[model samples]
Target: MLRTRRVGRGLSMAVCAVLTFSFFTACSRNKTGSSDSITVGVVLPITGREGKPGQYQREGIELAIKQINQNGGILVKDLDKKLPIKEVFYDDTSDQAKSAAFAERAMSSDNVVAVVGAYSTALGEAESVMPDRYQVPWITTGAAASTIFNHGYQYAFGTLSPTNLLGSTTAEYLGTLVDQRKLTKGLKLALALENTDHGVDYGNGIKEWIQQHPGYFVVVFSENFDLGSPDFSGLLQKVKSANADIFLADAHLQDYITMHRQYLQSGMRHLMISYGARGPESDARKALGDGVDYIFAGIWWSRNLPYPQVKKFNEDYKAFTGHEPDSWYPATAYDAMRALAKAIENAGTLNKTAIRDALRKVQLNDSLLPGQTLKFGANGQINTPFVIVQNKPGGKVDIVFPKDAATGDSIAPTPKH
Candidate 1:
């Protein structure tokens, strides 16, 4: 009986050892740090209000990853091998707290070498702190608020130029119209800015330009509105009473659609209308039809850009996504991923610190953005110029500013609706 008991105990020990080995083997396969691939984390508002633009950015990032993997992935010198990227992606659902939490979770739990995400100014602001805290590299694909970079964080980088540039660029474009006699000087401008750092920077940009070049434009009315507000009727009534010749508002995708729909319904018309970086979007067009026409925006990139690489990118993006991008969202996100990839290749290792340092030094000459080069400035934001684009009747969009890149003339003092 003692011998039989010993045999049973031996069998049980052998079974326990096998189970433990299998458990660890399964864990190693599931973990991102597995030797098979390099891991990167992506946190974006894939659902909720910011979902559309965030999805576009995700498409761009995925396209880049697909292309890189097809080319045998990135080379890691330390490993002496090329490994495909394995992404641990999450949806923040456009919640500010979720954005930060997801970023923290990615850095702390996923073992990702780097992360890219949080598409809006507010969301980006929320997630920006995680990079420095976790000692991971973060690249924001969409946020442009200057206040974000002013925090002195070393691990954070962004592809969007400052919102102030977007503002000043809009003012410069409008000033050009005044100089060419397309519009008369001393035009009164009514501003409906979103209540965020983005809006403040935009308002300041226009105000600064007006101060620098007097007699060009005047601010007749200015007001800020909460984001995602349902009704802009009260605001539109005030703007209507302002009697401004030009209407300018810095807004997000949904805000542009909602506000413009109300603007048209209220019969408030201006000589010119702009929604900061929010014109020519397919969703806006689908929402407002001809209502979105004659609107101009100063944006980071356009499919109308005249470059072989830009053309190729557009084609590649379309083939991969089954539809063309209607705004600047995807282009910036695509470049952000490419920039991160280039930095990884330059670092030649998955070391997070090395990747962060390499990001500061790497530059992409084949960038799809204007100037065809992507390089981060001292504050870790790109300083590329914004191109002004206008939507015309029958669904045509054209670049109307910077004569060298202009595909069509600006229809200043827009025709009656």
Candidate 2:
């Protein structure tokens, strides 16, 4: 999966990130905290549409705990003892109210000082408010919508990048194709996005990029579709009739799968295709087979990154899960657990306010993100970049953006049916 191609503004940053990403730890002696195991709560969609990614996140958190406990656990300054993490979580089952309710219960009855869970913007936003309400520090592992952090919440932090960037990055990459003469300028584009803050941000980002770089692309069709819509035939038919040269869609996992099936069946061919954060998923590739080939996506994690840490983690992750990783879902959750441990160690006490303060100022170098460093900004969101991945022929997934870190070149004007 490691092929090199440099595109967009992604390569050099990834190059620099590779240089900086390292397994970093803090050496501090502490006491007055829990002498036994520390409790951290998790709330993730385990049985719903978001369940697959949630399961990956859960594995990531659990694996991190196993690794940390094996070493000596986190040292508490006041207690003068190292403590292992004890995770208490409920399957949110992808329900909004349940996510918040489970988060509340975990903090109240489960005795969790902090939480490192929740996936997708909808559920993450639902659980986010409870953290501040309970004075608990919640770090989102999967949510990326900037709106979650825009409300001036102090106790919520996230490891995912912003959605606006997801769209902007995808468009910029397409511009590179035009620059390379692989794609023609003034191409008609169709925009299909989910009806949520995540989708709106993506649409705005793409529009902003197109505005800044005139003559590269023109929006011919745009529509908002609900998540989990069973029939995309009507929408696909519209897209087919639009005579668009490229298609950009923002959807979740299930939507991506459902819509792509309809897209392939509709026989609508585009020079390029993107599914926001939805393409390059393992299940999509398996379900659609070669139909997904050459499809590009703005993704959080790709094993194709030219980093030894990613490679090592991939191997360890497979060993822990007994299955290959579908995407980068686990890394953020793994980093979230590490971040929490670091904050707890630095805080020197189990005090929630102190830990929240610690979280705001915390920085971890050995992160699974493209930027190689995990630090939250004023919005409690990690300002990270993303990689554009292409599902190549022969079941291959490669990073084609940030040419410096790209594992392969993108194939445009995908073969027509």
Q: How does each model score on lDDT?
A: 0.93, 0.87
lDDT of residue 385 for candidate 1: 89
Candidate 1's residue-wise lDDT over 167-245, tens digit each?
Answer: 9999999999999999999999999999999999999999999999999999999999999999999999999999999
Which candidate number has the best TM-score?
Answer: 1
lDDT of 2 by residue, 207-243 (tens): 9999999999999999999998899999888988899
Against the true structure, whose lDDT is highest?
A: 1
Roughly what TM-score does model 1 have, to 2 decimal places? Answer: 0.94
